[model samples]
Target: MNSTLQPTALTEHVPQPVTRTERVQTIDLIRGFALLGILMMNIPGFGFPYTRFPLIYGTPGSTDFYTAMGIDTAFSGTMRALFSMLFGAGMLLFMAKKEDLASGHSVVDFYYRRLLWLVLFGVINAYVLLWPGDILYAYGLCGLLLYPFRKLRPAYLLIGMMLCMILPVLRNIQNTVETKQKRTTYWEAVKAEEQKKKLTDEQKKAKEEWENQLKWTKFDTKKDAEIVRKMQLGYGQVFAKLMPRNSNIESRGMYYGFWDMLGMMFLGMALLKLGFFTNKLPTSTYWLTLGLGYSIGLLLGNIQFYDQVAYILDPGAYVDTHFFSVFDLYDLRRGATAIGHASLLLLVYRSGVVPWLMKALANVGQMAFTNYLMQSIICTLIFYGYGFGYYGKLAFHQLYYVVAGVWVFQILFSAVWLRYFRFGPFEWLWRSLTYWKRQPMRLQSEPVPAAPQTALF
Candidate 1:
């Protein structure tokens, strides 16, 4: 194997086997790991009250808070970054293959159709399925942007990645600074209204508006209970409440995430170009990657997670908003940790340290699409009012039990399904849609790849 980072020769490009035939087992395993790990991060949101989870508020070092913080430190932004990067790498793989397979129609047309379908799926997930945090819409939207950058040089891709990654922090800083400015003006308006002199109407109105804004920003006991009330009513009712928040820029999901997803995808493309995901790197390289990435990433991730949790729970009138300025550097930590995690998984597999475990995880990754959507269905059935009515009933820590159960079931189910099937149900549907022909879903008469492109990137 060549050790240097260089492009494959023109002769290396050949007709791809098929879009549905996944050749990269390592990518599948990593994707499966990221998909499962992400659920750990999302379980709280699905099982407990939004914004205010199972926290003994203001108790920074308590076991409850520490447990949640620990989980966040381990997963949090890292898994999402890994997932996004993997998507980018998959895009490169898919396009590379499709370019060879294109005949009468253009490959770009097929790519657009795939993205548009994803956007449709995202809509269904968000509206009908009622997961406000459904990421498919964001992923598809960013993916549309990715097409133009598909053929960009690795150096340019890295530059694009840096800009996308950095923009969110810059936005956060702008928001924080602007928020402080509003606080200052809010107090001034109040002070003016309290003065002995006659007040201007604008100042009086400003006082009322700013006071309301301040009141709305803080989540108190009553607000938390009211949120629980809305969610516990009916799925339709909750849907009405959450649609705006998930779709718009002002909402937390889009606000914090708008650029970060694109940046991570670009970074993934760069890494894939470097052959980092191909298990082509030397063992020494993998070991060094694991060491430096985790050390630098996890340490910062821990401190930042702690501070954010503490700041959210702070009851002080003068909360330190500056602590949130740490968002500027948070992605580097997350991206690093994600890389560290991928390094560990790849190293483990390459060394044949735990071959059976690798095969199981790879199987799960192969069925990732079906498993990912199944998570949403199962979680909602457990948490929503329409299902078991466990809405707002569980603490953040308790949600992990449900996640663990699903994790076990998915691993086993995927393995079992692949034993007799060509693809997971959803994967088949996606492939059928992409190719304009129904894909074979059952086991073939002869020996065949148990799980083909079902979960393949």
Candidate 2:
């Protein structure tokens, strides 16, 4: 039907509020779910550094170790995978609207303009805000490359998704090799220094160089303490201390994230075209998806759980240069679990299992852009020296309490805000910029939908 519609003919519908009655609420609900769920994984990084790792391995049955393991095994990459696919689905939705408006206006303009702004936002987040693990930069890059693949058949899209995953796997392998080489070189230098009866100038220089190189490879409590102090000193001091180590911009920002994120985006597009996101699939199909996805994914995930635990805990593992072993199958495990999650969420949504909860989640999803930025701002202030200065203070498990608190606040705030306003504050700004027109914000003039008589609890 959209193919026959003139672009100008659909002008009135081009930028309608996503909350309108005609919208598919399930997508927004999942997005809202993702918006909150992601904090479960990200709180640690916000409180410390993303690269900050444990010096000693976890005790098998200990509280801290098992907590860390559970979080990583269940959530870490899964949330990111789900979030990336959702973004891809959103893009496809936007394109579908454009097709219906095929009035010859430059869809390219819309696509590029939105992603270009997103790229700028990513830069600010990474450098100015000093959140080194920011994914927006990576998303912008993936999105720039995704527009051309929009019309591919599902089979072709799946093929493309498989191809996109290769580079991240390769990138991880490359990192593992480089880490091994660095460790070997550093240890050899130490051995040589130990053997020397008198320290020669050349040998001393070599030892110092190797020591510096090894500093980043090992986890040192003293180094972590100093870094924490710097974070407490001021924002500028923290920025100076951390920026040099922000190498994710090189690795993840380049090939690794490009592959990992774009692959999921491709999968999302394929799924959307197949009507997966629109509740077109049967409940039985979703149940089977849930069963198979969780079985395969959780199996792969748990297989490495102990190995990863052992890798971090065993000093011998690091000394033996086997630190990279844990990540060997990271990509595949995450991909499987991500599908599992998507299936579970879709099944619940299609079943109308919890209308009130679903409505709240949809509100959150509609305002995800606003809430994401909000989280960054709030957490930085809460943890940095500039605000309450709680950086690097909490234990791994306790940090989640902060996450829970934030979620409660966001959900309650979002629900209340959406009742009166058509868009979240940041969403309105982004939409205005993307359209180059000031969109409506207040809902006072619009007819209000009748409120439910009963309380939601």
Estimate the overall C-alpha local distance difference test score of candidate 2: 0.70
Cα lDDT tens digits for candidate 2, 348-437: 766667777878887888788888878888888888887789998887677788998998899998999988887789878776777677
Per-residue lDDT of 325-438 in model 1, one digit per residue for the tens? 555687888999999999999988887889888888878887887888888889888887778878778766677788889999999999999888877888777767866766
Residue ranges of candidate 2 with Cα displaced over 4 Å: 1-19, 49-52, 99-104, 174-219, 245-252, 315-326, 445-457
Worst 10 residues of 1 by lDDT: 1-10
Estimated TM-score for each candidate: 0.87, 0.84
Q: Provide the RMSD of all predictions against the true structure, rounded to 1 decimal.
A: 4.1, 5.6
The local lDDT score (0 to 100) that residue 171 gets in candidate 1 is 77
The candidate that wins on lDDT is 1
